[model samples]
Target: MDSSVSSLTQYGSFRKPTFPLSNSCRHKPRRWPLALRFIKGAIHHVILVPILLHTLFTCIIVYIHINIQTLSVPANIVPSLSIVVGLMLVFRNSSSYDRYWGGRTNLQSIGTSVRNLTRSFLVCGPDRDEADRKETEKVVKVLVGMLYAVKNHLRSTWGHGYLLPEYKGLLPEGMYGFESEGVGLVLELAVVVERYIKRGVDRGAFNAPQSSMLSSQLNALVDAYGKMETIKLTPIPIAHQIHQKQVLALYCCVLPFCLVDELGWLCVPIICLICFMLYGIEGIGEEIEDPFGSDKNDIKIDAIIEDLRQEVSVLLDSWRRGGEEYTI
Candidate 1:
C-alpha cells in the first residue's frame, strides 16, 4: 500500500498544468439546474420543435388507443430497433468528437510553432545595428500578423481592414489585393515573412543552417493551418447526417406505441424524457463537430490569440532588455 501511494504521488507531480488558452478547460461545460438547463442548453433549443410535435403525437396515439382502437407494437421490437439506432448515434457522436479533439490538437501545434519561431528569430538572429533591430522587429510583427490572418481566414472574415491597427501598418502595401490574386491572406503574409527571411540571409543575419530551422517552423505553422482548414471545410457527409436523423426520428415516433399499452397516459411524459435524451445526444454532436465557430461550445480562439499576443509581447521585451547594458 505504501509503494502504491508513492507511485500515485509521483504520477500526480507530472500531470499537465491547465492554461486559459484551452477552451474546454477555460469554458467548462456548464451544469445549470434542471429547469434552467432546459432553457439554456443548445440541445434543448434544437430539439424543442421535435419534442413538442412528438409529445402531441404521443397524446393522440394514447387517446386513440384507449378510446377508439387497441393500438400496440410488440415489446421486443423496441429493444431490437433501439440496438440499431444506438449504434448509429454512437458512430456519429464518436466521429464528431474525433474532429473536435483533432481541431484542438492542431490549435496547440500552431501555438507551439509560433513560440518556437519567435524565440529563434529574436535570440538567434543578428541585431547588431539600428537597421538590423528594426528589421527583426518588423519580421516579429509580421509573424504575429500571420497568426491573426489565419484566424480571420478560418472564420471567413477577409480584408486587411479587419486586422489590428499595429499589425495593419506592418502588412505590405498590396496585401489588400490578396483576394483578387486568388491567394489566402494568411499564405500571402507567410510569403512576406519568407521574403524578409531571404533578405536576412542575403544580409548575413542568419547562417544557412539557422535559416533552414526557422523555415521548418514556418512550415509547421502552414501545416497546422491546412489541417484546421480541413476540419472547418470538410464536415461529416450530409447523407449520413440525414440518415441518422431519420433513424432517430423513427425511433422516437415508434417508442410511444410500444409504451402506451403497458404505461398508458404515463408514456406521454416518458416519451418526452426519452426524446430529450436521444435528440440531446445527436444535438451535442452537431454542436461540437465544427469546433471553430463563434458558438459558446466552440474553441475560444479569440482568447487563445490574445494569450499568444501576450506571449509575443513578453518575448519582444526580453529581446529589448538583452540588447541593453546592465550595471552590476
Candidate 2:
C-alpha cells in the first residue's frame, strides 16, 4: 500500500452525482429573444481602453471639421493598409486557434488514455485474491493521481490548496518541495504504475502481451503529458505578437482620420464598429492562445477533470459489483 493508493480509496468513497460536462464556456442561455449570441464575451471588455481613446480622438477630429474647417486624412490611405492588416489578423487568429485546438486534442487524448488504462486495470488486471485486489486498487489509484497531476501540471497549480482535498496527501513529502511538483508527481505515479505492472506480470497474473499492452497505454498517458507541457511552455512568437498589436493600433488610430471627412459626425459610430470587429477578433485570438486559462474562451480544464473523476468512479463501481467481464 502506497500512500497515494490509500488516499484514492478515501477519495473514492465520497462520489457525487455526475452532471453534464461542457468543454466550452458555461454561459446560461439568455431569456431575451433578441439577445445577440456573437457578443457573449466580445472584445469589449479587453479593448475598453483602446475604444475609449478612439472615441475621444474621433470627437476631436469632428470638432476640428466643424470649428476649424475640414481637416481629414485621405480615405485612400485605408485601402492601401487594409490588405496587410487583414492578412496579419487572419494569420494571428489562425495560429492561436491551432494552439487552442491542439490543447483540446491533447486533453482528449489524456482522457482517453485514462479511461482505457483504468478499465484495463480493473478488468484485465488480476483480482482473484485479496493481494490481487489490493494491488489492482493501488494501480487504479495511480491512474487517478496521474489525471489530477496532469491537470495541475498544465495549469501550473501545485502544492497545498491547488489539489482536490482528497488528493492533498497523495503525493509523497519529497514531491511537495520540487520546483515542478505537478509534473514530478505525474512522472512518479507513472513509474509506480510500471512497477505494479511488472509485479502483476511476475505474479503470473498477466502474460507478457497483457503487460505490454497495459504498458503501452501508460506510455500513451505519458506522451500526452509531454504534449501538454509542450503546448503550455511553447507560446506564440513574441515578435509576431508585438507586430500584430502594433498594426492593430495603427489601423484603429488612422481609421477615424480617414473616414471623418466623408461621414462627418457619423464617423464616430462607424469607427467604433470597425474597432469592435478588428479588436474583438484580436482579443479572441489572444484569449485562446493558452487555452488553459480562466478566460471565457479558454478550454474548460476543470470540467474535463471532473468528467475523468466521474468516469473512473463509475468504472470502479462496476468492478466492485462484479459485472460481466470487460473486453479491450
Candidate 3:
C-alpha cells in the first residue's frame, strides 16, 4: 500500500516527513555535477512554468529589437530594479528562516523535557515493588504518546483515530473521542502525566522539592507546545507577501527590455538565469515559512518522535535491569 494512504487510514491524516537538506557549515560537502544538482533541485520542479514563459518573453523582446523595431530601455533600469528586488528577497528569506529556526529550538526543548521527566520517574521515582515499576513504565509510554499527539496537533490531524497502536488503550476509558479543537488530546495526555506525578508524591516516590521539579519539567513541555502552536497558527502578514510578489513580477517583466539593448540575443539566457535565481529564492522562503508542514524543506517531525520513543525505551530497559539504581 502507498505510505500516504496507509497513514491516512491509520492516522486520519498523513504528512509524509522527509529529511531536511544539510545546512551545517562546519565542514564542506561533496559537490555534485551542475546537471545533477539541477535535476534534483526543488526549484526546477516548481519554477519550470514561469521559467519557460520568461524565456519566451525574453525571446520576443530580443526579436523585436533585432528585426521589426529598435525597442529598448535605458540600462539604468537593471541596477534600479536589482536594489529593490534584492532587499525584498533578503527580508523575506530572513524572516522565514527565523520561524524555521524557532520551531526547531522549541522541538528540542520538548524532547529534553521528556527525557528529564522520564529519567526522574524511572530512577528517582518510587520503585518499591513490581507494580511501581510497571506504573513508571506506563508513564514513560505516555511521554512517547505526548510527542505523537503534539505531532498530530501541529499537522492538524485530529481525532482518536490518529492514535497509533502503541498509544492506544493508554488514554483513560471514555476520554478518547473526536478532538475538534486539535489540542484537546495533547492536553489530556499532559493531564494524565501530571496525575501520575501527583500519585508518585502521594506514594512517597518523590519529596516536595523533587515533585516540584517534576512539575516544572511538565510545565516546560506545555510551554514548548504553546510556542509551537503559535508558530503553526500565526503566519507572515498577507500585505507584505502580496506587495513583495507584485514587485518581483514587475522587476522580471522589465528586466529583458533593459538588457536587450546591450546583450541583444545573448540577453535571452541571461534573463532566464536571473529569473531562475529570483524565483528560486522566493520559492524557498515560501516552502520553509511554515516549517511544520510536510514540505520537502519542513522539519522531519515524524523522525524526531520516533527517536524520542527509542530513547525512552532504552532508558527504561536499562533502569529495569539495574533495579532502579540507574542514575544518569
Candidate 4:
C-alpha cells in the first residue's frame, strides 16, 4: 500500500489498470451430457427419441427398405448411409459454440467497468485535514471492500469470511450474502461516500462539479453490480438444449449403419468413440453456460474478487503510511 500519493490520478490508473483482469475460474468437459439420452428436449433429440425408443427402429426400417428395394447388401447398412446427418451434426455443434462465445463477450464488460472505476479513484482529489483524510480513507476502504465482496459473491461462497482480513468487520452480521462479494463491499463503501458527501455539504468541502462527479462515479459502481448479476442470472436460453441433444443422438444412431460391414462386432467400440466426441462437445457447452457455476470452466469469482480487494487495500495502505503499511 502507498500513502505516498501517486502523480497519477485514480481515474487514470483505473481506466488502464496495470493489473490483470478477472476471468471465470472453471473448466468443463466438452462431451454432451450422458443423461441427455435419458432427458428429452433437443430438436435432433425429438427425431431420434422415437428412433431410440424402438430399439430396432433403424434396423427394421433399413432391413425392410433394403430387402423390398431389391438390394443385395444387408439392411443395417442402409440407415447409416445418409451423409446429411453428419453434416447437420456439425451445424448444431457450431451453433452451440457461438452461444458460448457470446457469453464470454458479456463477462468482459465487467473487467472494463473495474478498470474505469479504478481510474476514477486514482485521479480524484486528496486532502490533509482530519475530516478530509478520514473521508478519503473511508472511500478507499470501500474500494477494496467491493472487489473482495464481488469475487466471493460470484462464486456464491463466503470465502471472504476468512480470506480478506481488511474487510472482515465491514460485512453484514448474518447469512444470505451477495451475488458478488466485491460488489457488496463496494456498496458498503458507496454508502460511506453518500454519508461523506452529506457531511462535505455541511462543511463546504465539495463544490457543485465535484459532487456531481462523485455521484456519477457511485452510480457507475452500482451499475457494475447490476451488469454482473445480469450475466449470472440470465444465461443462454434452454431451447437450444433440446436441439443439441437431438443432433448428437441422431449422429450416434446412424453410426452403426455407417460401419457395420468392415468392423462387424467392432462397430460397437467405433460407434462409442463417435458418441464420445458428440457428447463431450455438448457437456462442455452446458458447463460454460453459467460461467459462475462450480464447473472448472467457471470464472473463479472468489479468487479474483478477493485479489482485487487486497490489491486496492494494499495500494491505499502504502499511500497512507508512506511505507509498507498494512502487513500481512
Best by TM-score: 1
Worst 10 residues of 3 by lDDT: 18-27
Candidate 4 colliding pairs, count: 61
lDDT of 2 by residue, 33-71 (tens): 543654555556787778778888888988888789887
Candidate 2 regions with alpha-carbon error over 4 angstroms: 1-40, 160-183, 323-328
TM of each candidate vs. truth: 0.85, 0.84, 0.84, 0.58
Model 2: number of clashes? 0
lDDT by residue (1-328, candidate 1, tens digit) is 8865785475446444444445334365556655565554356788789889999999999999999998998878889889989998999899999988888888888888878878877876667788877777777877777777777778887667545563564565545746656788778778877886787788888889988987888888899989999999999899999999999999999988899999999999999999888988899899889888777678877777767866676567557766332101
The TM-score that candidate 3 achieves is: 0.84
Give each model's whole-structure lDDT. Answer: 0.79, 0.76, 0.80, 0.53
What lDDT score goes with residue 132 in model 4? 69
What is candidate 3's lDDT per residue for 1-328, written digit by digit as tens? 5865764465433324422322212135548765567654365777778888889999999998899998888878678888999999999999999999999999889999998998788777777889888788777878888888888788987766335564674455456744764346678888888999899999998999999999999999999989999988888899989999889888888988888889999999998998899989998888888898765578877767777776776577667777333334
- For model 4 the local lDDT of residue 293 reads 52
Whole-model lDDT, candidate 3?
A: 0.80
- In terms of TM-score, how similar is model 4 to the real structure? 0.58
Q: What is the C-alpha RMSD of each candidate to the true structure, in Å?
A: 8.4, 6.4, 9.0, 9.7
The alpha-carbon root-mean-square deviation between model 3 and the true structure, to one decimal in Å, is 9.0
Which candidate order results from sorting by lDDT in descending order? 3, 1, 2, 4
Q: Is candidate 2 or candidate 3 better by lDDT?
A: 3
